[model samples]
Target: MNWCTRCVLPDTRPGIVLDAAGVCSACRAHGTRDEAVDWAARAAAFGELVERTRALDRRWDCVIPVSGGKDSTWQVVTCLEHGLHPLAVTWRTPGRTPLGQQNLDNLISLGVDHVDFTCSPLVERRFLLASLDRFGTTAIPMHLALFNVPLTVAARYDVPLVVWGENSAAEYVGDTAATHRLDAEWVRRYGAVHGTTAADWVSDELTERDLAPYFGPTDAELEAKGIEAVFLGEYLRWDPEMTARVAAEHGFRARDEGPRTGVYAHADIDDDFISIHHHLKWPKFGFTRSFDNLSLEIRNGRLTRDEAIARLRELGDETPYDDIAKFSAYVGIGTDDFFARAERWRNPDVWTRRDDGVWTIEGFLVDDWPWS
Candidate 1:
């Protein structure tokens, strides 16, 4: 439960490495970018990639997977700015917020051809519930669809390139080697699926046919089609605040209230279940969306350790009771059952219950903040 000395990230976060100097690997990785990256050369390489892909005989030059979030809007706009014809693809979440729908419509108004893919909600709900019961997350199916559907469309449409956003390994967890590219192996290992394939989820109630949409292209299939995927962040400096501001100028709307767990005013608004999914992580890992956002701000030089810790204390725990009722019903569970499952997943090693029935974690750097 130890925390990074330089940022708000906790050591409990999986795959995180803290150096002898006490800076988290993510911070160390950002330092490398500041000191060593050549943005101009990366941008040139991106331009060349676009040119090469556009030269292919397909009607669309590339596929851009989108969720109408700020990052996705930025991706679509970036492709358009580079004179590349990108077909925007969205795998519709179970609960689409009005604001999310509005922003998506606005993105479509930007003149890019868009496709919204939706699987059978009945099957999706079953998978969602199964994931929740087994992994304490309702996002597994969504993650699988997000990663697979775009590739499915690209293959069907004969597009040879798919442009993705930042490499999570490089930007979030500090695997610099993966910063330059994203492949199927990387997607399964680090992306939403996290090595759990759709086939692994098949059961008596859920058949292989019902899970077909979650199956991404095989490596051989991708190679046969000459398809490639690259991260846009590698070509440009990735600043979330800057991207959100730019997206706002193009009609992207921020949430009226900030998200249930994160400081960002305009992220993960497409689904109500997102907050619940993130909240579920707290019991297992002893951190939440607030920690994630604050760590990013610290790395980007927007907040000091004290400031970030103070803000986290003010925000408090981000349990999404507000949306729990609706979300539980959506997944065919009762609110009591939802709470029971959430409590069941709380790792005893990371949490302790007080006499008053309040739960807390120790070893968080925030507890040792100088001002606190």
Candidate 2:
């Protein structure tokens, strides 16, 4: 709720720190760019990685599972530029937003042969509803869609190396442990909890069991096959600004025309679900979806914490109409249940209860709800 005096980040951001002068570390780092980043060296290392990794057997030098976001585009282009025969994989999740589908289509048009993995919509819907009801969220398959599906495909097809768009800790947040450099542990403990983020708000339908499908090789499996999922950001210094500029030359657009931080910069792509969730988290955790991005913006002095928070507050809960209707129908519940759960998780102060014993928005439930 409170903006940091020195940086463009608000106190709502988790694990934020302020110096005596009220400045943030991102601001401090800005002063040391010459020492912090060596773009030439980074680019060279990236080239080296492509040359070296591609020299490996060529069964599939590497695979980049892409959603065709700015970052993914960069990753794919870089893989080719580096001389790697990279196979692209895309998962056709049920009810993919139009913008998301467009992004995917654009990615495929780049002449990269891609394999789309789409599962049973009924099964996906059942799990999506279960997770949404239990966790007050509909974006439950995020973990599986992002990590598991591509990984499973890689494993089954004998692809040894899988490349990800970016690494969170080094690019976005400060996880100053020595492991910040690309290494084995980066893959092992990539997350804080079981995976993804916290358990506070997830879809209930997607159980831990659902994740078992994507867990990439047992130690035995990885060892026997030498399977490695690498974060391209590591080893190569990640320059989001440069990545965006180049991606634009190759035709990248922001999904929402909003500020594309982190992996986005091209001014058009899908911003509703990811953007809305980040905006919602503002009042609760005080950070947007892309924390490192906010930090980067702060370091560069493009944004102020007050401005970020205010902008975040201005965002609305914009769910696509078809997605809302289909998800509601799939859950076998009306849209009321979906809205009620979402309102409860987002801003508890807005859920209104019926004075006449019906659930309505007559009043926000913050003061009335037991959870508050």
Candidate 3:
């Protein structure tokens, strides 16, 4: 697999492009921002958006999709600081941890009306198992609900704006097509829902009514209502550490146990099952959440590529064994069967079985990778 010379990311990752200089597209995109982002101008633009939305004289100025994570807290704080009344909305994950609930309550205490939108547990279970069985991901249902519910709320309430934390396409994949505005096309291409909508999942087991929450107002409907969805990261510089610090100042707590999915002690802590989604990237893409986190650190000058690679080596075989067990029980599937399903989706191009009956990635970035 070809690797980025500048960072640790591989071209094997979807939407990652390695240019002739051996720099990945994400690095190239970040470089442009480092050189060209005029924070003053961006902030002015955001201020204008706030003023324009406020002129509408709506009950709520915006809808902020939140998970009580650091980024969510940061978004809430930023929006409130701008004098925008935001209604924080959460697509309540079935696997939400106790810490998640506490953090969420803390977010609400920061002074914003909140909605904890929960899909029927039965529907979530069926959809999660279906996604795992078919697409090798347990996150499609989560993404669908997370992306949709906020838009639905915006439409229902006639809120003129939806404030999302980051433009993930620009931040992670470096898609040139990424923009500050989010529309239906962008969600289908970059939302990580496999380009399928809630309608695509209809079956004898799940009816149209069962998946109602997953269907947001259509783009045409939203357009007719003059609602706009935008990324807050576009206006302000986004740094995980910075956001974590901001969140901590506002009572957002990190996992006391330590980092769950990646190197961040503050991230992915709200949902227990989210780690399973990140861990699955190992067999399928020959990388883990550490790769993504470390790559970002490399971009931010926090770690050299060599140092990040060493850290990845030290983080060896980051299989979320406990998360897998938790997800298996939640979905009412045996652990053995769950792993069998995961292993079936392992990318053959990135992995090969060794003579000792262990799988290994040939020419892995780390010379002494622990395949066992």
Candidate 4:
């Protein structure tokens, strides 16, 4: 597979462009939009949002869901500086990486009060396993960590307004999903299912027959409670790299301890893995490492077209088999047949059909987990 000549993303991605010089359309599109955004104006707009939200109640003025990633850190700092007494909320997931832990600590050190929301370790483990079993991903906790608990906590505290760092599709990923993206919908669907993810993993333990009292959403909740969720990045000029630099200046250090090729996520933050998982799942989707390396090259500015191709050829056939096993064990499945089932989910075209008739994936799908 070739990286889009325009932005360094892969050409296989539908709607992405590939030019002769090996740039992708995402890059070109971003270039166009970047020129139009008045970042200071957007920040002014954010201040207005803060003011309007604060005027809504005497309850905790605002709630900022934070994982201490650069964007979250920036949001919290902005909230605190605005003199809004914000409640920092986080969902502690299993395998919270070392850097993630530090980011959380830093948030505490910054003197904002926070609620540490966590699940039983066993429950977290089981969920990871279940995520692997059901969705082929063990990092499902990271995906769910940002949602659910916040609203549940909001109801308890009666905190009506919540600020989030950014919306993936609208702000950073691209604008295809932007026109109709609604903030209220983001609030409702954070924990259930997303536009891009499956719903069964988190709710699997609850039997449909028994979940009558807990159906996903109740319209009455939104109509009366004034529960408002806002996306900070959409109306603002935002760049992850720029945010990272700002975060570093504010004492947010890189979790220098994790993987280089794959993002070693901060202990509990959600940003890195969401990007990395795409790479893990890409091979399963028939795209190769071309898509993975290209993004980095775009970010770092070293990704030549030829270099991307060579790297894909060199890296395409790897998988995370050990991660799959650990994820399997965490969820309590020990059968060899399960791995076989997982193997079947691999990128159907690139995964191997072994001599024994069972399928084999790039060893990286869940392979070579140093933690295990």
Assess every candidate by TM-score: 0.96, 0.71, 0.98, 0.72
Off by over 4 Å in 1: 368-372
> lDDT (0-100) at residue 56 of candidate 4?
75
Candidate 1's TM-score reads 0.96
lDDT of 4 at 147: 61
Ranking by TM-score: 3, 1, 4, 2
Q: What's the lDDT for all of these models?
A: 0.84, 0.56, 0.92, 0.56
lDDT of 4 at 97: 54
- True lDDT of residue 76, candidate 4: 77
Error of 3 at 185 (Å): 1.1
| Candidate with the larger TM-score of 1 and 4 | 1
lDDT of 2 at 124: 63
For 154-226, candidate 2 gives per-residue lDDT tens digits of 7787776788866665444444342533333453354422233322323464444544543444446655776
Clash count, candidate 4: 27
> Which candidate should be chosen as best, given TM-score against the real structure?
3
**Highest lDDT model number:** 3
Per residue, candidate 1 scores C-alpha lDDT tens digits across 160-275 of 99999878888888888763666667877687565798889999989999999998887688879998878899888888898898899898999887764588888878787788
Candidate 2: C-alpha lDDT: 0.56
